[model samples]
Target: MKIRNLRLLPLLGLTSLISLNAAAVTVEHKPTDQIIIKFDNANVEGNSQARTLSTRLNKKLAFVRKTSQGSYVFRLPSRENFSSVKAYLKVLKAISGIKYAEADQMMFAINDLAVPPTEGIVGTKKPIYDLQWHYFEPVGGMNADGAWNQLDSSDSVVNVAVLDTGITAHPDLDANVIGGTDMITAQSISNDGDGRDADPSDPGDWVSRGECYLGSKASNSSWHGTHVSGTISAFTNNSAGVAGVGYNKINIVPVRILGKCGGYTSDIADAIVWAATGEDNPNKAQVINMSIGGAGSCNATYQQAIDTAVAAGTTIVVAAGNSDDDAGNYTPASCNNVISVASTNRAGGRAYYSNYGDVVDLAAPGGETSTGARNGVLSTLNEGTTVPAAPTYAYYQGTSMAAPHVAAVAGLLYVKKPSVTPTEVKTILTSTARAFPDSCVQCGSGILDAGAAIAALDGSVTPTEPAAPSNFTAIAGAGTVTLNWSDQSTNETGFYIEKRRKFSNQWGTYRSVVRAAADSTSYQDSVFGGTYQYRIRSQNSTGDSAWVVSGEVSVSRN
Candidate 1:
């Protein structure tokens, strides 16, 4: 029966193609200046009636096409007013057949924003605040001066989109905000008016409206969106609040999605699309930060929206999630196109609450809970109504805080190399990451190195050479033989060496030696004393190169 169904599909395809001739006619009639509207469900009976109603209201309304289910697509006049569009949708809603009508902006959800400490964590001895950054510095091929110097030319006018709760009116964020929109409703998402022009009243939290379920709610909260915005691009050298990642020159576009308990997937999707490419509205964002996510499979609508954003020249940075599960369980983070970031403690180990997986592109300083060691991330915070003093600076801890660091760095990179593609950005980030202990499998690329990423942007750093092996000799007096090798390089922080018996087709476990300088490289084996094969490679602050193999030596213990 399955085979027969497959056989009939081709015939059905042909029939559909044949009937598409008239459908193709509508494409030509679509207005170049008009925005596109797509209903969630076109098969609803009201949708068909809406199509007919559209024709009566204006001669400019022309039916464009229909989905396989018979939902109609119509093109509105280029000059149609916003009120008219709303009235038309209201008319359709009054009909029983229509489900939901939305402009093209309602498709993608924005990525949200991260660090921290203690035993049971990797790199526990190191300070959590700079662990990941320090780890990536050498591997990223950057020095202290190179890292700090790159910031000057990289953050002039970069734009980063904060897609979360609405950003409040804070002095630090005031200069950085470019523009934004509200996906939950047509009203402006900013606490201020349109285009970051004026301040608006913040409506704190809301009860679930049966439209979406975002889980629990916090009793006390300052505008999350505003705080996140300040962290990424707050005005630098400002006498008031804490400094931001990209200094004051970077621009932020806030797309509010999460409000009350949680946000709806539908609304979040729209924010993602609009934030990246400025659909329906005129605000085009260069980088999108999604600090919030839920458990569910990646939907087609969301994936399509992300693809559109990437094509339009935007870099999406997403949090791996606080659930502590592998990133595969998350949607946009797991999505192949975007950069998925995991959380690490200040000590440079995986954060307990951070999600892990091979899909994770990088790790940052996400704070941990067990050790009383707060990750202490510096960023802006809302002062609340009583305070009313612009956004204040504070230390936050979480994968949420860590994510913006990467986003801010990406923004700086964009400013330096505007021509860098999303893929190249990902490469620069991943390739320069620092490896962490016990993080070999979980951390994916390694800790994100801002300096290394920037240095590699223009190909200014020199690549490190691979380390050599030493002390090749067989044990005397026994059939079992032991061989030793010495470390041959200075910058080598770790050694990856492998050995295999002569007759065996596969090599034994590949050993990773850590923190070894040019002086140390020795391996002891208790196997046959005859001829044996060996291979060694060195990894350091720069990166690991190809393994240098030893000559096939013929030695006898007897």
Candidate 2:
């Protein structure tokens, strides 16, 4: 996709806001203007200070709604209006306990719109597996082909909620999708003329540079959601345009949040919660793939929703952001409990644009578009910009493409171990990750390896008397604790392990053990409770996973 230089245009006055609508926007103070003030607190103006402030301002305020953050939305009625929105903010800031007051700002998607293939195909009998080198190349490629044979492709229990522009019609994906929902609230912006509804279809987020006061050039509709969905689950083996990380569309659940000018921060926060249905709610997504993000640290609204989803047993895999800056500055990725993924190129080196930092949990093949489509990541796409047109396949770049790879892998993990905890999934992935074949300092612990991850579950390959293991866990005992996932499936007999006391917040050496496991499902190690950690992996005629230790787990005794 080609990114046109974007210009930020702030909607400053009531006239500009009112000029936006085909009809007048019913605002708080001016029943006539469209501006809304995000107040920090509720209006019990009965309080002396509030009453005085309310009286001084002639126009009374009314409560709108409490936003995701504890802040309140209060409309200061237009008194033939006395000042500009800038002046109104100044007055509101003067009041005591007024956390913050400003107009609800607008945001847009930070994606570059590239031209689609001019000569499109209605359908194809063969999937261009070669076109998707990002999935097949060994250097940085995810071992998706091997994982497909092991995972339950059609298991209705697993579904990945794609929170992006929404998925549209494509022959390769139509059969795999169960259903979707539209979460866009701004009716005019949605272009669908509706607020929230059951239709989670992409309406093409193509925009003219002037629409949002963007100084960049106009663009064609980039089928962003469809491309993202294809990476996770485009119908495979149908001889279509491309293969997928998981199975076909059945694995994806489209949850639309982005529209005409990207989407609001508030809309995305709500979709995160909705994807994981609560009590009496039937929507149960095991993995939520937010291949979307923008600048800024996490806000309370995004923080709360992420916490709720994790508590509900959902694993969120997010893009580490395309900014190349520290992942710490991007949202949802920087948010707690998410498996943040950075992008790696064909040679296992970090993609030039992938954001990196302590927040990223792993790395995956997101591809580089500098050399054009053949070198970029290919997935599902559409020929239209504002409406649905012929189905096609195109290449795209960005950490946006990297996220679904990890999300689908998490989905595969769920199919293998339905009883696995979200914490365990993170541990196993970080543990079994294969070291990058090239230099990618701090991209994450390692690149994803599917074959090693499912080895224990399938009872296929076994481990030999070798080095250590990955994703090891312990069961507390009087003097001994047993390590987990050290399975001696079929070929080899046992495993070699290592231990450290996490002294001074640092791990010691593995010189203590020669061999720590055998022909059993787990290995037993003796220890006391100061916080012990271990590392091990299943090995065969082939080699075992990387020696990276799983994150520390606390052990205790009654």
Evaluated with lDDT, which candidate comes out highest? Answer: 2
lDDT of 1 by residue, 277-369 (tens): 666546577788876665543545456667877887899888776666777776666776888887776566777667778778888665543
lDDT of 1: 0.53
Q: What is the Cα-based TM-score of model 1?
A: 0.57
TM-score leader: 2
Query: Which segments of candidate 1 are over 4 A away from where they belong?
Result: 1-146, 152-156, 186-202, 206-218, 280-283, 385-390, 437-441, 462-558
TM-score of each: 0.57, 0.67
Candidate 2's TM-score: 0.67
Tally clashes: model 2: 16
